[model samples]
Every structure is written in C-alpha cells, then in structure tokens.
Target: MNFRQKNVLLILLACFPFGLIAQAQKKKSKVVTDPVFSAFSYKGNDAIYTDNPLKADEFYNPILQGCYPDPSITKKGNDYYLVNSSFSMFPGVPIFHSNDLVNWKQIGHVLDRRSQLKVDSAGISAGIYAPDIKYNPGNETFYMITTQIASGIGNMVVKTKDPLKGWSDPKKLNFDGIDPSIFFDDNGKAYITHNDAPDRGKTLYNGHRVIKIWEYDLQNDQVIPGTDKIIVDGGVDITQKPIWIEGPHLYKKNGKYYLMCAEGGTGGWHSEVIFVSDSPTGPFKPAPSNPILTQRHFPKDRKDKVDWAGHADLVEGPDGKYYGVFLGIRPNNQDRVNAGRETFMLPVDWSGEFPVFENGLIPMRPKLKVPKGTERKWEQGGYFQNGNFTFNEDFSKDTLDFRWIGVRGPREEFIAKTKDGLIIKPSERNIKSNKVTSTLFHRQQHNAFEAAFTLKYAPRSATDMAGLVCYQSERFNYVFGITRKGTEDFLVLAKTNKGETTVVASVKIDTGKPVRLQVVANHDEYRFNYSTDGTNFQNLGGTVSGDVLSTNVAGGFTGSLIGLYATTGNDIQPQ
Candidate 1:
C-alpha cells in the first residue's frame, strides 16, 4: 500500500509543477500578443493613415500649437532646437529639440534659473518677449537674444553648449529697444540689430517703423556706437509697402544677407517680409519678392479669424527644407474669446532666387518623411471620453506615459510617486505670481477633451489642497479640490481670467476623509465630480464660469493646459 501510493502521489505532484510552468509560459505569450501591449508602442513602428494629407499628425506640429509666440529655431547638423516667449510664465525660455523636424520632444528648459529671465509677478503681459535664436558655424554654439517686455530698454543674451540643458547667465546688452537679433557673419563677426529711432532724443520726430543694424563686438559683448545704420526705414518706401517691422532674423546665402523681419502686429493680422543686401550693415533693398510670408490675408477657408501672426524664424532642416516657424490663432468659434494663437509652419519658397509664398497659404503640414514602419497614431482626445488625464486600476510604473507637464514649468519638487499612487506637492503661489510656482499642471490641448484622475491626499495643514485643473493662463483657470481648513473640509472652485480669479464656490468638504477628485471638461464647459470612495461620485456643480483662456489671453504663445495641480496660496514662505 505504501510504495505504490507514494510513487503515484509523487508523479501527480511532479505533473502539477510542469503544468504550472506551461501555464505561466502561455500567460507570458498572451501578454506579448496583446494589442494594447504592442499597439501602445512608443517606437511608432506601426503605420496608420490619417485623412490629413498635409502630414499634420506628426509631432504635435503646431508644436507650439497655440500662441506660442515669437518662435526661434536654430539647426545644428541634423538636430533642430526651438525656444519661445515664456512671458510671465516662470522657467522662461522653454527649450525643445527634434532630430526629425516633425517629431519634436522637449528635453529641458534652457532658462530654468531665475537669473536667466525675470518676469515680475505675472502681470498684464510683462516678461520675456520675442527671443531670437542663432547658431555660429565657427564655434558651433547656439545663442538666444530675448527682450524683457516690462523692463523696456535692456535685452539679454544666453548661450548653451546643449540646447536641452540650462543656459549661461544672460550677458545684458544695455542697449535700448525691443525685438533684438544677432547676425553671425561668415567673416566671424557678430552683429546686433534692434528697433531704433531715426531721430534720437526727439519724440515725434523718431519714426517707429525703422529697424537698424550695427556691427556688434561680441568679444567685448557690447553694441558698438556709430557702427549702427538704418537698414530698413518704412518712411521712405511707398509702393513697396509694409506697416510695422519687428522681430528680425538675419541670414546670408548666395552672396546676399537676407534680413527677415515680422511685420503688421502679433495680432491675427501678422505678416513677414524679407530684404536683401550684400552687407550686414545694409542700405538694404526689399527682396525682389517682398512679404515672403503673411497670414493677415489668408483665403476665405484659410483665415485664422483671430488676429496676430508672423513672429517667425527660418531653420534649415536636416533634409535641407527651409521652414518658417510662425504663430497664428484659431478662434474657438464660440461666443467667448479663445485666446490661444496656433503656431504654423510653411516651407519658404524660393522663386527666382527670392523667397515667394503661395497666396495666403501658409503651409500647415508636416515635412518629415514618414518613418518606415507601421503607422499607428493615438488621438489627443480619448476614443470614449474627452479629458486631459486618464487613470486605471493598472498602476504600474509604466502607467504614466509622456503626456504630463508641470504648471508654470516642471520641477522635481512638484512631482513624486510610489508603486501605489502618484503625488503632487503644493507650490506656494498661484499662476499669476512671479515665483514660477503654480500647482504643477500640464496642458489640456484639445478643444473637446476630458480629464480624469484618481488619487489619495493626506494634507498636514488646513490650506493643503490638491486636485485636477483646467488652466488657460494665470488669470483664467478653474480647479476642483478638497482642502483642509481647520477641522472643516473646504471644497473649492477658483475661477480666474482677465487678471482676476474670484472664488466662485466654497462648500464644506464631506467629513468622511476626502481621498479622490475627478474633474471632466468638455469644450469650454467644465463639470466637477468627487469621490470619498473610489466607486461612488458626487456632482459638486458646473456653475463655475470663466473664459477658456487660449493663446489670446494667457499671454504666452501656448495652448490651454489641463493637468494635476496642488496649491497652498501664500501659506508657505517664498523660494
């Protein structure tokens, strides 16, 4: 009885081990075969087709998307670098890099340090204005010239070894004017050009439409006196007409220095013109084909409808496509003003050795050769819902994809996580403050979108509050949060826009230990729902009212953002 039974039981136990091993292999094979595991690939190996013939699906072109104004692009070999106006937004000069012009990814901000730029207290449009980017062939370095909009007369220069990292401390050029550009000549001379008055010390006598260029001594790092000359003066030219001239970029090609300047205004009616001369200090003649690009007069179907275009820069792609990155705005077509100005790229066309553009057709298409792979692209809006954030029970380290950004700018202090959950720390100030400290937030870039989040918050102080936010700018943002005020819990709704954020709703937080907050936004309307328990939700209210701040209002050249944010307004000490 003992020997036979023992042998049979041992065989059965051994069979169980082999069976478990086979089942484990089958489970692994299933995961490898799953569409979500493979289709959610980042390699972009899969190819899919879009109705967009213009290749608009790649790299979130309109990369600067809405109103990311005064774009400056510098190309270094196959790598392209970009920077934009962070006006009033902290962490100025947000820099990005793209190997393929169509697929851009932000590496890190160049002006993360406070010494780099100063935007005092996010007031009405006062900060880094119109940055111009250039590369030197001799030294193989990149440089940026930026204006302090509120400060008036001084412009700063910051250089970088890598465009992704922090830039050198700005070497202040005490020269008075705005829209400054540095032209690096083949002869190894650096020249600075900016808006200068024709008649100095005289108020009405000075023509505002004139732009002057002068040989600058970069070795000494100063604007040279008397070396300056008026390159383009609108007071003289009549038939070859242009209204406002600013944001100049100088590049020499084929024995002529091309002076490219943005005209009209940044408003929806923006335009750009190019002039050529044999010298950097030019008694320049307008390009045989003047006004190389202008969106002020797009076709009936092409009109952006909102004002402001043309703060542009020319970057030669790795494939040698001469591309112009410029900013334009598309109205939400809603009664409320959509303040976002969309950025567009059109190839610079050379007609008879001069740049020519197809009438009002600023090419809004991607130029990169589609990578040789299966084309699979994800839509910005969800297939089932329209929100910025998505969450699930599957909380792996991999659940957080690349779709998150910190408010004002990104910082290590703003984010943290464990295997269990994600946590965001409250920054001391609101978006309007100079501290660049806002509850860390990411953009809600879609017109119709939904954002959802699942989190547990443990606040040490009554002022501690963390939740999801749909923010257009400092003044125009709405947040849904569970805050601790004394022993009482305060559910808050803060509505801000047009330099004012009125607390529209504040109610007693239900006492059952508030843990999770979910806010869903569709178009301009927002709905707030909360859950003390993960399954059940309470509708707080949609009575909160504010304009969906776009490029038009937030005052930056960026789109609206919806992301996780935590705030402790004025409760903590300044940085």
Candidate 2:
C-alpha cells in the first residue's frame, strides 16, 4: 500500500457522491474497446428436427421460428392471443401468449413505443405488414389491426383490455390497404376487413385484390363514416386471375359470415381461401373448398418441404379444437428461402360447412398431433421449440429479451446493458442503412443453425465495424466483423448481393483478444467463422451462398435476419 499510500487512497475515493456514480459507470464501461461480446449462442440443427423426433404425441411445425410471418390469431376465454409479421423490425408487432394452444409465450410488442412504430425510414421490406389479433367478446376488447408502412402509418389500430398488460398507442386506421381484419359481431356489430383495390378504376387482373368491409366505430375506433363494404371480390375467383388477394380473416362461425382470404402472390402461388356471409356486409360465398389452405399443389421436391402456404388465422382451441394460424415456407438446398416466414399450426376441420386445414391438403408434415388434453406434457417448459433447440443469451439482463430485436431504430437507440457485455453503440448508420443502425436482430431461427458470439471488439477505424449479420434486407446481407485494415486488425468476410459488396474473406485479427463470431447455416451453405482461443475455431468464409438469404432471393416478405452488427459507417473490405 505504498505509492504515496496509493495516491492518498485514490484521492480519498474520488470525493464521494457515490464516488461520482462510480466514475460514470467506469466511463460507461469503456464504450467497448476490446473483449466485447456479451454472450450469445443459438443452436437449432433442423434436419426436419433431426429427421423427425418429438413424439409424446407430436407437435412442432414452426411454432414461431425465424421471420415469424403473417400469422394472426385470437381467443379470449381460455386465453390465446398471437400475432407476427414485424416488417421493418424494431419492435413492430410480435405478441404471443397461450394456454395450451401448443404452449407459446412471448408477451410483448404490440408496436412497442417510438410513437407506436414509425419504422424510422422504412424499408427492410418496409415496416410492419399483416398483423391482426382480435377478440371482441362484444367489448371485452383487444384488437391489433395493422399495416404501418412507415412514417405516414397506413392502416392501424391498437387496443388492449389486457394482453398480459400492454398495448394501445397507435389508432390511425382510416385505412388504405394491406391485410386489416377486425370483426366482432353478435348484435354488438363491428367490422373492418381489409386488402383493397378493384373498385377504383374497376381494374381486373394483375393480382386485382379487393375485400373491404368497414362500419367499425367501436365507440369511435374509426372506420364508420361511409360504411365501406366490398367483401370478397378478387379472391376465391376473380375468374382465376386472382393474384395477391391479401390476408383477410373475418369470422362468426355457426351463424355464418366467414370471409378468410390470402390468395396467391405471397410467392410460389400462396393461398388460403374461403368466403361465405349472411351479413357483416358481403354476398361473400365461394368455397367449393376453395383453397382451404394450399402449398400450391405440392411437389417442389417435397421432403420436409413446406412452401409459401398462406396467411391464415382462426382460433378456437382450448380443446374445442379449430385452430389454424398460418404463413409457411422452409426451403433451402436451393429451392431458396432462408428461415423467413414461419409460424404454422394446423387443425381446423369445423365439421363440414367450410374450414379444412387439418393437415391441409397434404405435403406439409413437420409433425403435429398432440391435442389430447391440449399439450399433454409438452416436455417441461411446456414446449416452445424449433426442433433441435438451445438459445442462450445473457447481456446481463434487466430487459432486452423479447428475443432481441431492432432494425429501423430504437433498441433504446443503440443498446447498453453493462456489468460488462451488451453495449453495442456503434451506429452512425451501416448495415446498409435504410436508417436505423446499431443492428441487433435475431430471427434466422434455423435451416440448420449454429450461431455464436462472445465479443470484445476493437475496430477504431476503417470506419469501425462490429460483427455478425446475415440479414436479408436493407439489400441482402452477411458481413462478419472486426475492421481496421491499415495498422492491422482484420477479420472481414463481407458478401451483400443486391446492394453490392464482396469481401469474401480476410484475417490478421487479435482485436485485443476475446472474439468468437460464428454463423453456420448449412441449408444451402453459408459459413464464416473466427475465434481467438474461445476454443480454437477458424474458417473465414468458405461455404457461402444461402442465396443471399433467400425470400425467393431476397425480394422480401422477410425471413432470415441474423444481426448483432455495429457500425460508424464501415464500408466493408477484404477481397
């Protein structure tokens, strides 16, 4: 203890004030200089979940995995609410909760903050699309309706009498188009149905959409004014020119007023028809079993293949059976698609007058049966699987675990967990910026997974860069980190197709020690590795070509977003 008595006891413990808040959290934990990661590790090996396993009576066809597509469901008594499609990411819409509908549980994000999702500058496929959770019970309330195309907020609504406690912020809903949905009838009346076009200019083909409805006014929740009504037109059969007749969903069961919808145009000719109606405005009708769900007549090399199925919704299960919730696609070995667009679930016989999907039109078996007593022992955590699982994330908690998201902005702006880990903070825009920076994503759920992280960066220049990203938008992706090329410190890898990038590989590391950065996919290849004693690891690029993380070659309806990137505008380099 000499050294002038340790500098007079560190200047007498920096003159109190809790030592100046412990010297500003030790200078905000060195804003990440080296040894940076905060631990991450995903697993899911998917070979049809190791060639078909789970069987305590089965269950697992993408109970929410990867891009979590356009699914929407509702139920109140035995409580089961679900929703998906978070287009420009950034907490757009992801809401789940179940009571044995097969165990789901992610109770948050109904357009979480930022004035209810503005989608920064949009374009990661352009902000939220197709989200529609409902449950009116004549006012027991809970409506989500969505379409937020960014900034101008197109088609909206958000309520909650309770969704595990959270919601209500956006209300916009004057409507324009793109999957709306809201129907609550039984003398309490209330409607809103969506997906438009067909009247204006009376157009006919080229995906001529239609399906209108309107007369909502649930005590001024909008939509009244003109009574709207157009019900089903371009769908079920616009003379077979039916193109993108978007996701609709309207129901009333027994007394009839069905509606459903979602025809072709979501890729590979998607579908899910149905339409009938005695009221709720619609001469509806059109169900000679019309696409009661479709994998477009199968044969895309079938074998654990589940293609662009549909955009369904339909609930009733607490053993009363019914259930639907759609949006499929799991392609690889080059049929394309990269873990984007998931969330399945079947069972929907409805005795006879319409409502099929019980193993809907064949070729979709990823396994499912367990309905006996609702989830009869879904193996402990009550099941929430993606087959071969293992997630492991620990940014020193206290929050940030809605499965870690962020894209067009707001992840508390640029993250900051601490006690030494999740601090990210790079953002000066990068990841090909369409606005929001400081990446973070997570949703590439599996098509063969591996993921890994355990950082401690040290970029400092080459316009700084931080690692891992397999994203499929903001112009296709795949980066692999560590920057600075001048005074050394490399580790690149690049590869962005539609936005033009190409650095194949690089090395020269030692970014101040702790590093890990993996990736691994394998359904059509994609490698990229690194390590610095976290047990040897090496492989900088090698495999490649998960077809720019497919969505039929990244055209987008999303799927495959594996971020955790950082920036300062790094332009990427290596080659």
Cα lDDT of all candidates, in order? 0.59, 0.81
lDDT of 1 by residue, 387-477 (tens): 1223233225653443344433445556555555555556766555545553544444444434455645544455566665666666666
The local lDDT score (0 to 100) that residue 264 gets in candidate 1 is 67
Clashes of each: 43, 6
The alpha-carbon lDDT assigned to residue 288 of candidate 1 equals: 53
lDDT per residue for candidate 2 within 420-472, as digits (tens), equals 68877787778877988888888888888888887888876787888888888
